[model samples]
Target: MSNMNVIVEKLLAIDGALAAAIVDSNSGMILGSGGSGVDLELAAAGNTEVVRAKTKTMKSLGLKDNIEDILITLGKQYHILRPIDKQDGLFIYAVLDKSKANLALARRKVLDAEQALVM
Candidate 1:
């Protein structure tokens, strides 16, 4: 298993990664983070709401499945949220410059990192 710092470092290695944070959905807190283009502290809280809302909606719809990831595309960047398969209430938030990133590869990298992340 990799430490939090290492995981954050790995996330930053992705092309165009602006920032990455490990967020606790239950509390909207950033457990660990790296990179600098964005304010992860603020993003964590807002994104927590995003996760919670989606979860609630899924439950309401009776969708009996897990979320692989959440993507929010912007004109200049993409925000990716990857919740751990084995760990409830925790997720990785990544931002990438849309022009520089390969969406498919970035998603795959997040999944690979999620499996190795230490809670």
Candidate 2:
């Protein structure tokens, strides 16, 4: 396994990748970030709420599960938020250009990067 920096670097190499960050869902803090065309700080904070909300809703509904990932499709972009396994409260966030990115491939890349991430 590689460090968080290596994971972020690998994520940026994905086709049409715009930004990437490893965020602390518990505190909404960004541990590492890379790429451009987006404000990673803002994204980290906003997306933390997204993770919390979904988790909370699942608990309320009595569902025992984990969040594989959250994909938000915009008019021109794709945002993927994947919680890291074995690392509670940390997630990988990635943004891609909708027109230039292959959604399935990009999602898989994000999952791969998350899996390879070390502290």
Candidate 3:
């Protein structure tokens, strides 16, 4: 299993990756982060809310499903929030330059990193 730093490093190796972090959705805290461009700390906190809101909405609707990832596309960036399948209240947040990123490949890489993440 990979540690947090290792996971962040692997994420950075992906094309167009601008930043990456492991965040706790429960408290909106960042456990580990790497790379640059956007403010990872702020992003982690904000995205935590996004996760909470989505989960709440899902439960309200009684959707018997899980969120694989949340993708936010901006004019210049692509933000990915993937909840760790092995743990509760933790997630992987990755930001990428839209012009430089291959969304499919990036998503696949995130999934690969998620599976190997130790904590």
Candidate 4:
């Protein structure tokens, strides 16, 4: 299994990774992070809302399925937010350059990292 640092580093190894952070959703706080193109602190706060909104919407819609991840695509970037199943109220946020990232592979890596991560 990987620790936070290792997980962040592994994420940075992705072809287009610009930044990555492990965030606490309950507090919108960043626990650990690596890489830098965007400000991770700000990203954490914004993504916290992203998670909350989706969760709230799901509840309202009466969808019983849990969210595995959320993807936000911009003109040049891709923001991926993945909640860690084993770590309650925590998530992995990764930003990638859309021009270089393979979305499928990046998502898979985040999933693997989540499994290996220790709360």
**Judged by lDDT, which candidate is best?**
3
In model 2, where is the ten-residue run with the lowest total lDDT? Answer: 110-119
Write one digit per residue (lDDT tens) for candidate 2, span 6-117. Answer: 8999899989999999999999999999999988998899999999999999999999999999999999999999999879999999999999899999989998998787
lDDT string for model 3 (25-84, tens) is: 999999989999998988999999999999999999999999999999999999999999
Clashes of 2: 0
TM-score of 1: 0.96
- Scored against the true structure, residue 45 in model 1 reaches a CA lDDT of 95
Instruction: Write candidate 4's Cα lDDT for 12-98 as tens digits.
Output: 998899999999999999989999899899889989999999999999999999899999999999999999998889999999999
Identify the leading candidate in terms of TM-score: 3
* Residue 55 lDDT in candidate 4: 93
Q: Which scores higher on lDDT, 1 or 4?
A: 4
Q: lDDT of each structure?
A: 0.92, 0.92, 0.95, 0.93
- Poorest lDDT segment (10 consecutive residues) of candidate 4: 1-10
Give one clash count per candidate, in the order shown.
0, 0, 0, 0
- Show model 3 residue runs off by greater than 4 Å: none
C-alpha lDDT of candidate 2 relative to the true structure: 0.92
